[model samples]
Target: MAITTFPMIEKCTSIDRENDIVVTDLDGTLLRGRNSFAYFALVAFDVDGVLRLLFLLLASPIAGILYYFISESAGIQVIVFATFVGMKVFDIESAARNVLPKFYSEDLHPESWRVFSSCGKTCVLTATPRIMVEPFLKDYLGTDIVLGTEIETYKGRATGFVRPPGVLVGKNKVDTLTSTFGDTQPDIGLGDRDTDIPFMTLCKEGYFVPSNLKVNAVSTKVLPKPIVFHDGRFIKKLTPLVSLLIILWIPLGFLLACVRLSVMSFLPIPLQYYAFLATGIRLIINGIPPLHIKKSKGLLFVCCHKTILDNIFLSVALDRPVPVVTYSTSRFLNIFSPIKTITLTRDRAFDASMIKKLLKQRDLTIFPEGTTSRGQFLLRFSSLFAEITNEIVPVAMETKMSMFHGTTTRGWKWMDPFFFLMNPRPTYEITFLNKLSYEFTCKSGKSSHEVANYVQKVIAETLSYECTTFTRKDKYMALDTIVKNP
Candidate 1:
């Protein structure tokens, strides 16, 4: 005596008397690996099915290739028909049971995800022999009906001849299913192979699995969004793969040896030195930050204040014709110094006029924060250069795996680059968040103050940092009062 049980529980729903017939296909839809499993079953049953199929083709090369393509493309029809003709009915229950683990798993199989509550009356309508498939039906699939090929048996011994349900291909599949369940219909239909096409067509809407397959079993193909797997790491498709690859490869030994001496040679010169050096300097920065320029036109980069080396690294990373918008004294300092002519004037009264000229002539880089924090808290940003007409791209920079604000300006001299030289190797991570519109269109009809807060909040969120806002009164409040007169 054998037993029957459904693996998952089903939700009970009384079928409306009007429309209760739910017909679906089995092979590629309900049955995950029907073709390969059926082939395995035939091999297990006849033991020479593989050799016989091969010998048949070896006897006739053309017929063998045709058979291969037929088996590959329309697996359900060829395997079922071939199995029925190959051997007498034997107990395929064990063979079918053995194949269950391959088809279903907690991982790849989608059956567990979509089955929902299994209280409803269900059945599996397949073209496979009933005995060879009943195990999957009893174990993995809880569907009530199993309408497949009928195998002959005498005293539970082997008899090769099989009787298939009348014309079990295509539309006849819908008829078989309807005959099994009568007027009761199911809520969902699924199929994968081309032979299951007619069976799926019986349903209102059905989805094909592994949708890229040429011969889809269902009309509408439903598939998960593609995720990228690179070197055993999963990433979203939109994430920048090339930039990440460059970052990871920069710390390699061989590549470092080749370009290290060349890298050290440019250290004595100001970052602006490499900036104007042009050709080779351009290639180095291109490897660091790959830019996606639109129309080959230059754009402005708004950044945070870190150090003088900050502007240099920006110039090198950007590689484009961007002139840093610094103060008049800084511009004067760079004029006699090794700095290029791209630095802008920071005269307060003429700030608006100068910005218009910079946008018209060249791409501008401005540190909107105006002052530097110890790499910890983001300070209130000055709205001075925020009104630039050119595109404003906010660039957030932080060192990877470094102590918070490694050396503060209070302890280290602001003018000297000694701290940078003395410190051990620093791996700086610079991430360029997407470009914002040049025009500051206030969202939700926000006022200037609200807009400023929003911009500050947006930048803070983008960099994964916190910021403190100080009003004019807050700054004026005696530092001695907060310090307790000590």
Candidate 2:
């Protein structure tokens, strides 16, 4: 059958909001990418580590040749095999839920979104696996259905192979669409490349998305909600070259981490800043100058936690060693920590009494959020700090690492500080706000929870972050729900 060429995607305006059924391709049409290698690298690293990412990088040349020179299906299969093979099914789905949406929500194509978002009934057809792209499409994009390639899994792991209709490219996509929709053809179809062309032809109307590099990403305000939390150790978008650099630099990075920790252990507080500067670690301190506070009960510094090093960076800002009450850090971290650390047992009364006693000796720091947050967000604050002392200083912290993040809930906790120090020039910004008013204090007849929420709000506003009631337990619960429900 001979068919005529359709108009370009720019013509796909005036979409019906009530009843139009739009079937759009994923990678290039919906997302601004010629391929999905970056996303594959993300899943690879998120699931295993740099070693798994290195494995995928080593195989990309093979995948590239198969995809560009030969069949797209064969190319996608090779890439899929490298990324998914031997990985636990639970891990893949977990990344799909927690990690992928944040990236996917950022990569939406403007023109495709203009048409795709208008329709009430929408379907995303992609060569990527269904489990991977489905959560983002259905939950974030409001798609009614998502048809993607099925990965073959055995027992509880991916077998690195696609199920029967294989890699959903070219003719396979058309067949799948036909099987799913039958005689009732979709009203609008959007696609990018030649493979997408086949499936687009099956729709009543087809539109082409050209490879244009000038297109800007749609504003993030269009999203249902901002990404408050995300999982992964990567500090930047992973490319093949970046992955190679990480694999090559791990040995030196590890050694660097050790040297930094060693210096922090013995170096005097004032000289530590210069020492860090010499080692290519940056600590950017802004806001008002630190006030001199001498009290029997030391000043309580409240913070929204970003990483394990929050207390360390907070002390750096004040140019003095401050004792901290920790939550889930290993004994190794506590033993070798430069300053004092007292582990909390989560017992409200016992922990409160411990912190109160510790504060009386000298200046003490506390991260009331309990756990670290990866983005510009503050978890619910524990109010015990407010009740202890009215002399409180709220500190807002932001960390930028080009290589690796310092915090992880799923991996080894002790290695977190090491990963943070291993970066080429990790940047930390500390913003100190004025001390809290006595009127908002527990001594003013206000409840402890009220003080906690007030402090959380001040820090959130200072950082321009939205407040979430989610605590550390809420984070783990969300991750657990992914495996159980998926």
Best by TM-score: 2
lDDT of 2 by residue, 282-341 (tens): 999878454564222467888888877777777776787777776655555566667777
CA RMSD of all predictions: 21.8, 2.9
Off by over 4 Å in 1: 1-298, 328-349, 400-415, 438-452, 471-486
Off by over 4 Å in 2: 1-4, 288-291, 294-297, 481-486
lDDT of each: 0.43, 0.81
- Mind giving the per-residue lDDT tens digits that candidate 1 earns over 218-241? 211232211110010111111123
Count of steric clashes across candidates, in order = 24, 0
RMSD of 2: 2.9
Give the Cα RMSD of candidate 1: 21.8
Worst 10 residues of 1 by lDDT: 227-236
The TM-scores of all predictions, comma-separated, are: 0.35, 0.93
